[model samples]
Target: MGELEQKFAAAFLTEGRWILYFKGLGVTLGIAVLAAILGVIFGTVLGIMKLSFREDGKKTLWNILATAYVDVIRGTPSVLQLLIMWFIVFATWNNGVAVASISFGLNSAAYVSEIVRGGILAVDVGQMEAGRSLGLSKAMTMRYIILPQALKNMVPPLGNEFITLLKETAIVGYVSLTDLTRAANQIASRTYEAFMPLIGTAVIYFVVIKILTLLLGVLERRLRESDQR
Candidate 1:
């Protein structure tokens, strides 16, 4: 092996590199979790607005706006999206990490809104009617009854979205965010052993996703049990 490779391989197996790896993992996960939480909140609000039937023009406008947001984010490449946010929208934030988190979060929100809207629609209309018959206002029924059920149904899809967001956070590298992918890239540059860094990053991502999936599965089972009772 080359001298640099030998040195890096030793570091990779040492305590210091392990710490750096874990630190990068934390940053990646932190960004993802924050983004997922913010996305769900924003998405729910947008989804509800899109579903509103009050004004034809207003509804159309909201639909057009939300659709535009989703289409634009979905159509463009994620790396380019990160660069745009870094250079354009968040030029003032000056914090690459924050910019990356917010951009990805907002992007995720657009997609999540559609997921939530589908879940809301999947509920039978009869249920809403029943809720209304029981002296519940539309908003009340939605908040207490309809939304609860819809959210339960949304769990599986949300889990998938969470996994996707986790992976997408890697794009933060474009913004100079020192996330797992960036860390791996840096290591590869120094070590010149492309396999170690890429494979290591892949393994870390896989383990994290697996854990998330397992946790979501537990949540799904709990929700199902609640439904049974």
Candidate 2:
């Protein structure tokens, strides 16, 4: 037990190294949460634009632009996108957190746009027809009838997407930002022990993801309950 304690002490407790982990956690959560918000907002707009052709199957400019955005983002590597944003687009900006947040948000928006478009399309055709039959216009039916039902379908996928974005934030280290994974790597370099730092970081990530999964489950249950009522 003393040997185990020594290893633990050397890995984490030495010279206030544990502070690194806490700082990294703050950066990770901050960038992920901010990125998720931006993704949802921008993705919703892209999704709406992507659906612009649904009315008459015409290829509108908005739909074309949205399609191009989604395609390019999906085709490229996320790390490259981060590098481009940091080294080129926001080169003068020294805020690593903000840069990472925007980069990940842009990447996430592509996928989230697809999710949003699918969720909206998944609603029953009858729902829209029924709304229109009741003297509602296309936009009104979409807002009043279709969207409410679609929200439930959207929740699960959106939750999953945000969770993925959370994990992907680990790459923020490429920009010299000491996020969680980077913190652990730094710890390993300091202590010359891979087991403790890496494993500890993995545990931290698993705990966060598990908690989020549980919360999503609760939300799903509530959505079901609302449907029943």
Candidate 3:
């Protein structure tokens, strides 16, 4: 066997080292899911506030604050944001997972807010008018009529955001959080076999992203069919 093959065998195919990868995968997934959920909730509120009442020619305090947050987050690199969160914003907090989650969640929210805002704007004005004609208040119209269609539009972009956020969690390793990338790095350092460990990590990420993309495609197709029916 070649030297590379020997390294691979020693690093991954022996002594249950693959378990490290599994554990790292769990941490990565946990961070991604938590961040994505929080991002969606926070982004939805920001999107609604930014989009709402704009026709009235006045901005609310919430809108101003949301706008500033989105701009700051979107304008900054995510790695920088992560460092700031870990070292500065939550300096007193010792939970790496929670810190990583909040950091990525806030970063993801900026993009998600734009996606949601675009989706809501894509909804027809006539829908809101019709709901209003039926005595629905603006809030009721949004909740009952506008939001459903907007949510459908939001799914594709939101799925993309989740995938992006999943990959971004690799940076959590910088804060000493042992995610998949960090686990692979540790293996590389210990085994002195960078190729096998790093390549394996890349393959794992690719496989996960491919599976998620396939699922999202199926969901989009079903939504299209439902709209047709």
Candidate 4:
């Protein structure tokens, strides 16, 4: 076999090393999916808080707090945030996957909040006023009327955020988790050939992300079609 073929074999086909990639991919997806869900949930609340203001056009305490949270998370590097979360915030926790998910989720939430805030604002202000005129509570209007309209605006950016989160989870290795990137690194350490393992890992990531992007495109089309009807 040629050197490249030998390296490929050693990196993957030999000794069932492919299982490592599979397992690591699972972890990577787990963290990304869980983190995306968590980020959306918390980020929505943060976005709402940020939008809260007094009738006098002054910011509420909730707005200040939410803004501070978003600011702090956005200001720091994600790797440093991950390290802090893993080593300090979750020091006693042995479940690196869960910790990493929470860490990345919190990080993603900062950006997601801005996306959500923008989506909510993109919704026509008259929608809220109309709901209120119909005797709907503000909360009910936000839930059934405003949020549904805003969701279409949110989906595209939210997909981007999820993709970014997926890539960022590569640093979960800092927490001792053998995610896809770390799995490739380990395989390369043993195989003594960086090209095959590293490039293979990159290829896997690209393929997965491309699939996600296609899915998002489909969803956007469906939303557009629904609106046209």
Candidate 5:
């Protein structure tokens, strides 16, 4: 076995290099959380903008902008976007993780914006009118009546988006971020024992996402139970 493999195998049995692995894990999770949070916020605003169309000209403009953004982001591969964000947008910066977060945040924002738009469209028009009739401003109606219901509908999809963002973080390795996947890649490169490191990384991702899915499930159940009343 290669030296790195021996070290890893020993570590697997005895907690060697555990600190580095956990540090990488922390970094990966940190980026995923930050990106997903920012993405959702930005997306909500853009989605509202896309939907805020009274005049035909305004509608056309927002539609074109939203459509172009969604199409371009969805059409292009994420890794390429990461590279562009790294080399072009934050060229002078040395922090690879920051670049990764920004790229993922922006890319995810494009998708999450569509999710928000769909959720908003799903809300009943009568409820909006009711809010307006109750002396609520348009903004107040949206904030109080429209958005709350839409947000409930948004949770499942947003959770899925979080999972997707977590996986997408692997791409940060290309920019040399040393995230979980990057750590595994480094270990594999040194050890020449590809399967163990890959399996380890996959397990890490699976466990993290599975935990999130379970938590979201509990939240979904609570939301549904409340809705039944």
Candidate 6:
């Protein structure tokens, strides 16, 4: 037991290991944030396209294309999608961070689109009719009236998506991006002690995720209060 404790301490308590964890945490958070932002923007456009209707109430070409994209992405596993993005589409790009960001962002967009689409659909059609009756163009009505209410409905799902994306970033290390999991793997390799490094990494992830959950809970409460007002 004494020897085991010493080995564990040496593996993680050493000066440089904490820095590795910090750097990995930074990379993971950076990729997740950039991907979430991009995903939200791209997904919003796709959702809007999916919701678009012609004067005759027929679906537009854009809606068909968006549907196909969402189907393809949602039907596939994200890890496989990430692998293809890294190994094939962006094969010429050597930057792992950029590749990971783009891959995750694109993958996330599909699900986010569905979430947004559902939220938009939940709004009453009468709302759109009212806006149009007020002389608001379709675009203006969607932008100002529909989207605001839809977004409030979307908040909880978006929060879950963000959390899922953050955890999914663990696989980014497969592309040689040294995120938290990869950092732990490296430490384990050097120390030849798997438990300490891996457990520490798990603890870090749990703490970070807990913090995010708390923050999201607060935001959800605020949104609910606003709705009541």
Q: What Cα-based lDDT does every candidate model obtain? A: 0.83, 0.93, 0.91, 0.94, 0.84, 0.91
**Total backbone clashes of candidate 5, pairs 3 or more residues apart or in separate chains:** 0
Model 1 whole-model lDDT (C-alpha atoms): 0.83
| Tens digit per residue, CA lDDT, model 2, 131-226 | 999999999999988988888999999999989999999999999999999999998888888888898899999999999999999998888886
At residue 110, give the lDDT of candidate 2: 93
For every candidate structure, what is the RMSD over all alpha carbons to the true structure, in angstroms? 2.9, 1.4, 1.6, 1.4, 2.9, 1.7
For each candidate in turn, the TM-score is 0.90, 0.96, 0.94, 0.96, 0.89, 0.93
Give me the displacement of residue 25 in model 5, in angstroms.
1.2
lDDT of 5 by residue, 1-229 (tens): 5976766574353445555568778889989988998899888877877786755545757667877788899899999999998888899999877778888998999989989998988999999999999999999999999998998888899998999999888888888788888887777776667777788878988998899999999998887776856
lDDT of 4 by residue, 151-184 (tens): 9999999999999999999998877899999999
Worst 10 residues of 5 by lDDT: 10-19
The residue ranges of model 2 lying beyond 4 angstroms of the native Cα positions read 54-56
TM-score of 2: 0.96
For model 6, give the 10-residue run with minimal summed lDDT.
7-16
What are the per-residue Cα lDDT tens digits for candidate 1 across 4-83? 67665754765467666777888899899888989999998878766766554455667778777878878888778788
Poorly placed runs, candidate 6 (over 4 Å): 1-4
Q: Once superposed on the true structure, which residue ranges of model 4 sit more than 4 Å away at CA?
A: none
TM-score of 5: 0.89
- Clash counts for all predictions: 0, 0, 0, 0, 0, 0
lDDT value, candidate 3, whole model = 0.91
Pitting candidate 5 against candidate 6, the one with the higher lDDT is 6
